[model samples]
Each structure stands twice: as C-alpha cells, then as structure tokens.
Target: MALFATMSMTAGVSPATAGPEQWKIMPLGDSITHGDGSSTQSSYRADLWRILYPTHPGLDFVGSQQSGQLPDTDHEGHGGWMIDDLRAKTIGWIVAFQPRTILLHIGTNDMDRGPEPEQAPQRLGALLDDIEKAVPGTQVFVATLVPSKKAAVQERIDRFNAAVPGVVAGRAHVSLVRMDGLDPDLDLRDDLHPNDRGYGKMASLWGAALGG
Candidate 1:
C-alpha cells in the first residue's frame, strides 16, 4: 500500500537545540532501533542520527531503546509484543520525553506472536490513540512495518501495514511512512534483521520522509 498524507511538524517551533526549545526526535521501536544483529554504530538508528544531525543543525535526537524491549519502545518489542503490551509500556515514555517528533517503527513482533490475523488494525489503532492522549501536540510519523522475507511473517506484516493508515486516519499530526518496497534484496543474513546496507537504506528512507 501507499503512504498516507503528509503531516506538518508541530507549529511555533524553531529548529531544535540543546536548550529547552530544542526539538527532540525519539526513535521508539524494538531491536531495529537498538541495532540488533548489527554493530552499534552501524545500526540504522545511529546511521539516521549521523544523517540527521548535520542536516537539521538544530534538532537534538535521542534514542531510548533496549534490546528486546517490548511494544518496541515502551515495553519490549522483541518476543512479539501485542497491542496490549504496547499500551502498557510505551505511553508513559513518550509523555515523559515530550519530543517534538517521534519516529515510530513497531508491530513486527506482534506478527511473530500469531495474534488473530484480523486484529492487527484494532491493536494498532489503540496504540495510536494512546500516543495521541499521551503526547497531545507531538508529531507522529507512523512507519509501515518493514517486511520480512519469511513468507508467513511477511504476510502478517502486509496485513499490519494495511491497517496502519486507518489507525492514524484524520489525525493531522500523524503520517504513514511506506518502507515496504524500498529494500527488496533483503540483505539480511537472518532473514529478519537488516544488514548494514539494509540499515543504510532504512535510514535513508526515513531521512527522506523527514525532509532531511
């Protein structure tokens, strides 16, 4: 599926800085953000930071991630955190950070757990609602969950991606970023996590989405 409409950054804000007015971009997700299966500096999130730092020149990007954390950022995304775990763990952290923009990549683990195939949308919707409540003015970039080469996992990812747009519907501050067709080669030795090249592509796509 295609991406959703473009959403504006939060208003009345200058570029981020080290001070109070600084815009903080938080990468909230599971192992992807943690750079699993790759070296720490080579992880996509780190690569993204390298790309974004000089480009933005004002924004202060911070990462709050734990390897195998659930709900991705809030709890633990690894080991298949369903929507329920997301609601419980991630909401508070987003609120506490009060970031201007949030880069959210989640729901992959949920597919692994084998929840009712049809329930992905509802769960994602609920997660969106919780995020809105927790951070009223935060600009949310909802990434289309990346595809795994594994047939069963990829099928579930497809269904989850389809459901993401509906969850963020009518939210002017939310946008769906399509990462589906960007990397077809897989480039992953594990057939799950991305290798350095794949991570570079992922970071590049996100940089494009952010207009970096």
Candidate 2:
C-alpha cells in the first residue's frame, strides 16, 4: 500500500489526546515554514500534523512565535529571516520549550541578502551547534531548500544544499531531509515560497522522516 495509507492504518490505532503543552515540537525556519504562499496559510505544519498526530497523539508544536492555521500554531518561522538570525534565537527557544523534536528549514533568506551566501552551510552548522548545546537529546530534522525560480539564487541554494550532509555528518540526533525535488515552475507561488501543493510535499517528507 501507499505510505499515507499505511499512516492512516497506524493512526486509527490511537485517540488524539496529547497537545502542544505536552510534546513541544518546534518548526524552525523562515517564510516557507510560516506558510507565506499557501492559500490556507497552514504550511507543512498543518499537513505534518495530519500525518503524525494520530500516531503521536501527545505531539505538541511549540515555539515563541506562532503562525499558520494549525491547531498547534506555535513555530519559530520568521519572514525574511536568515540562518544567522535564527541562530541568535535558537538557544533561547530550545531552552524555553525544551522541544522533543525540531523541524529546521532555513538559509534561503541568506541567499537573498547576505554578505556571503556561500557561507550559509557554515552558518547552518553553527545553528545546529547551538541546538545541540541547548538540548542534546532532542531530535532535529534539517531540510535542504526547495528550488527557487531565480537561477542566481538557485546556484547558491545548490551549493548550500551540497554542503548540508557534511554539516550533519557527525551529529547523531540530526538527519537531513532533501527538499530539492520541488519544481520551481510548478511548486513555487512566487520566486521563493512554495505553493500549497509544494508545502504538502514537504509535509510528506517530514512525516516520513519522523515516522522512521
């Protein structure tokens, strides 16, 4: 059967009970994570909630900042924020919520306006380092960026994506989610943001990672 079908089968085994106050899952990133282009403004978090909630009834999305239409709307996504910007906030957020899992997709904003876009991976590494220091046991999922329409930006994204595995190599609590398969012409609502369908695809990947 299909993956989601399997998820459905598994999900029915439990009743929804756990909430954001109990499970503390942080969705950390920029505009995409904030659901900027989606019609419902639900983002992947909504769909990811659909996929994981039934099985993880106690799962809670936690962050200081909240957006999207999800029941657990808490998240750390900021519009136009870059890796370094997030790095500055990560330690404090982790300390506050003490999340059980962290979904991280950042760095695209760095390509838009930064002194050195090429340094994104290094900056991502630093963010991960901060995350590790804050909460050693929390599971962290880092995603490669979805495709951008602009060729110049895509080039920087490609280089940054290529270096992600290296940044995640030694970290046992972290895993890489390759989000580069999105078709910019079809998946993007604008130059940088994913449309609803694209966000759904992202949610599927995240669900698969977490389910594993």
Candidate 3:
C-alpha cells in the first residue's frame, strides 16, 4: 500500500510532455496484451489505435516493452506473468510512463496454473488499489479474460471473470468491460489466446469502453 511509486525512471524515454490534446494510454496485462495469437503480433493495441486514432488524433499508447509491427508498439504486456507480477511493477511503470489511462487484462496465468483460483479477484483488487493510490485521476478499464476452449480452464476463467465487476466496484476511475460473445471454438487460436478476428473484437470492446 505504498502511495508513491519509487523508481529511477531513468531507463526509458524522458517523462512525457503531452500537450493538452494528447492522451497516453498504457495497456497493462499478459500475452494477450502482447498480441500472442495474432498473425501480426500487434495484439489489440494496433487495432485499438486504428479505431481511436482517427477521431482522437493524440491517442498514444505508452510502455517500456515493445512488440508488434505498428507505429505505436509500446506496451507493458508480459507473457506468462501473473497478477502479482504486474502489481510489483505497476508503480514503476506508472512513474516512468505517466499514462493518463490504463487498460488492464490479467489473471489468466493464475487461473491456468494455480491451486487457488478464488484469490485472483483479491489480488486484482490489490493491484487496482496500488494503481488508484499511484495516480488517482488516471482512467482505468478492467476487462474480463477472453474465453478458453478447455472445460477445466474455462470453468476457472468463468469464476474469475465473474468476480471482476465486484473487484472493480467503488473504484471511481475504474470501469469494467465485459468480453462476452467471444466463442472459444471460433475466436481463439489456441487454448487461451485470441486470433486476429478475436483481437479485432477485443479492440472494438476497448474502443467502446474508451468512448471512441
């Protein structure tokens, strides 16, 4: 529950000097954020940019890590990372990037490789607490994980996703965006990752959440 994020902030580009019209958005999550199943590996970030950039010309995606082939490839999407991993680094990334908006889609790994699925919601809440404390004004959008094909994994996913709204409740800047209607048999490329079409669907949902 540290209020201020303590980090050097020296490694990346200098602190953002965004103009009044510009908005820096950070996509913070796992491989889905990294564009794992997409052919272009741009993930939903690229498609999201395409959706929002025309109207919101200054919509900038910022992060330490880089992937994809798009012009704005920056993001904080780490593959195989859990909610706690993101929690540990959230403050540092916030301090470095100074994003005004954060898109968080996490906890898939915890559900996939865990003995305890019930605790993910609490961990997610803790991460949100840190984010709210680090920068209270920042707009946060929390999305439920996309569907999975495997019955056992999907069951855990269903339970975890079901608790997300409750986790995000009462956080003034945080909003819940449900990723429903994505068929695992059709949308997913692998067990858990989304294909290009699925990423497009995700981008559409994120775009709607951002009011684009």
Query: Would you estimate the TM-scores of all the predictions?
Result: 0.77, 0.88, 0.89
Highest-scoring model, lDDT: 3
Residue range 108-187, candidate 2, lDDT tens digits: 88977776998888889888888887778888999999989989999888998899999999987999999999989888
Report lDDT per candidate: 0.67, 0.87, 0.90
Rank order by lDDT, top first?
3, 2, 1
Each candidate: RMSD: 9.8, 8.6, 7.8
Number of the candidate with higher lDDT, 1 or 2: 2
Per-residue alpha-carbon lDDT of candidate 1 for residues 1-212, written as tens digits (9 for 90 to 100): 11211221333333352234365777766666566656442446656766776656566654444432222222223334555675687777776666788777777777766568578778767777788887787788888876687788888888888778877788768888887764546556355677777777788888888887
Error of 1 at 129 (Å): 1.0
Write the residue-wise lDDT of candidate 3 on 18-51 in tens digits: 3447889999999999999999888998889998
Worst 10 residues of 2 by lDDT: 13-22
Query: Candidate 3, which ten residues in sequence have the lowest lDDT sum?
Result: 1-10
